[model samples]
Target: MRIDGRARALIAADDRGLLYGDGLFETLRVRAGVCPLWDRHVARLRVGCRRLRLPPPAAGALERDRDALIAGAADAVLRITWTRGSGMRGYAPPLAATPRCVLALAPAPAIPVHWYARGIRVRFCDVRLARQPRLAGIKHLNRLEQVLARAEWRDAAIAEGLMLDTGGHVIGATAANVFAVIDDMLVTPRLDQAGVAGVGRAVLLDAFPKTRVRALRRTDLERASEVLLVSAVRGALPVRRLDARRLPVGPWAR
Candidate 1:
């Protein structure tokens, strides 16, 4: 995809993101020409930059650039990527780095009206995310694990796939964070070791203060009263089935 004001055929050859997947990205839902969670996304991007030891760009400048990119789209998915820019021939980060930021806008995926009403089916993926506390809860560019997991299923019958960590703990879905209702309590996986803390998850937790974040096992998920997959673009989707286990629709599932 083209970035900035240029039509380069490919991403910069020397980009650290290309070399080592050293970058952070945010996916935001654009509704009616406005990004509702723009501030929160920007906050997370800034925090990710700090954690990665990268220079933060001017907020106004970045917003202006992003707005220009999405000005034509009525409803779209806005993705902003921040990389460590070009680097020398080594793993060591450069002392004087000019961070590269890319803003792109694309059409949002069409959501089936019936799927939202009847809930969606999901399956457990075999790909296990490696535990890395340092990178936990951040939307980093290293997504090979998710890419692999998503490829496991080609059937249109399955809507999403839930993922677990190496420790066999339920972390999240392939492309979204998971939340479930157990014993009338809202529970979601704690992203202390794996998984990206999704922006939609943050909004739900903030909206419902009683929601709890904790480590969940496979058994806990199976016994949950309701399961929901959440993402910035998809909002909250009820889970109908996971693998061979069939989950019944409940009031909480709504």
Candidate 2:
């Protein structure tokens, strides 16, 4: 692990990221010593930095760190966490805050090999996401909502849980974005109010530019013929069942 462009393991205890979640992160899948979606990830990170009012990393700082860590490496998951460095005991940020970027590379998660071919089951989470348009669509450090939603179930048969915002709008899954095929039309939820706009969802939208982006409800998901849960780690997985509703793995998911 490297922090602030150096090979280090620890950060200050008073760091704003640790105290108040004042940071953003990007999780990229690395293959053959390269990130497949580096450009998209950087683009999203730039947007996140702009929204969070934090200084972007130094020129080529991330690239240099990534190169040093993934040298001659095989498949892995590289997470880059950028945080507002240590500050006094308060919510207001320091004027000359020095941001810290920590890069950690780990073995790629072992996904069920058959999940792609055979869909996975999911349930609706009881925890409702707080609607915060200012923080929507960015990969921020605060993830308690997702954490609580994930803890809702522990059944091995259930792969994930769909999360809804306070207004009953389908935000996304605990970790991924949701896509539905309603009336033979591809549709996804709008992230203006809540949820992260994942890169996998962006890939699908680029592939199918006609896919509608709108406010979706549980009823819309129920009416859909097929649904897909997409994420950066797991590209796209078909949803075999939503709670008790049986869904088919159609050509879209295949």
Candidate 3:
């Protein structure tokens, strides 16, 4: 782990990321020592920094740290986290706070190959995401809601759980983005109200010209011909069952 461009494993106890969840994090897939989706991660990080009023580190600095951590790794998960530097007590941030950047590399877990071929089953989470447009679409460090939602299930057969916004609109799953195919067109929930706008979702939207971004209801998902769960690390997995409904693993998923 590299903290603020230095090689270290310890961070200050008063660090804003620890004291208060004032930070942002990006998780990218490192393949053969190279991150294919680096640009997208950086782009999303910048958006988070801008929204959170945190200064972003130099692009070159981040790349250097990432390269150093991923040295010679074949396949790994690289995480870059930034927090408002240590400060005094209370929620009001210091005026001239320096940002802290931490980067780490971990071995990528082996995913079930059959999940991609045969599809995976998912469940609807009881936890509803609170609508916060200011924090929406960014991979921020404040993920207690997700933590709670993930704990709602203990079934190993369920690959992911779908979540809805406080207003009852389908947002996404615990970690990945959700998409449904209807009438030969792709539809994904809009992040303007809630949910993280993921890099894989952006890739899919660009790849499929018929993609549409808007509010999605549970009925919309039930009526769709196919459902897909996408993320930078997972790539794409077809959803064969959502709740008690069985969805088709269509050709588009392949």
Lowest-sum lDDT 10-residue window in model 3: 55-64
Tens digits of per-residue lDDT, candidate 2, 110-213, equal 89988999899999999999999999999999999999999988899999999999999998999999999999998999999999999999999999999999
User: In candidate 1, what residue range of length 10 has the lowest lDDT sum?
Assistant: 1-10
- Which residues of candidate 2, in runs, are more than 4 Å off? none
Off by over 4 Å in 1: 5-9
Q: Report the Cα lDDT for candidate 1.
A: 0.88
What is the C-alpha RMSD, rounded to one decimal, of candidate 3?
A: 0.9
lDDT of 1 by residue, 1-254 (tens): 33654434357799998899888999999987889999989989888888899898775877777767676678899888889999997899999988888887789899998777888999999999999998999999999999999999999989999999999999999989999988889999999998999899999999889998899999999889789999999998888887888776667656
Please report the candidate that would top lDDT against the real structure: 2
Q: Count the backbone clashes (under 3 Å) in each candidate.
A: 0, 0, 0
Residue-wise C-alpha lDDT for candidate 3, range 14-64, written one tens digit per residue: 999999999999999999989999999999999999999998878599988
C-alpha lDDT score of every prediction, in listed order:
0.88, 0.94, 0.92
TM-score of each predicted structure versus truth: 0.96, 0.98, 0.98
**Ranking under TM-score, best-scoring first?**
2, 3, 1
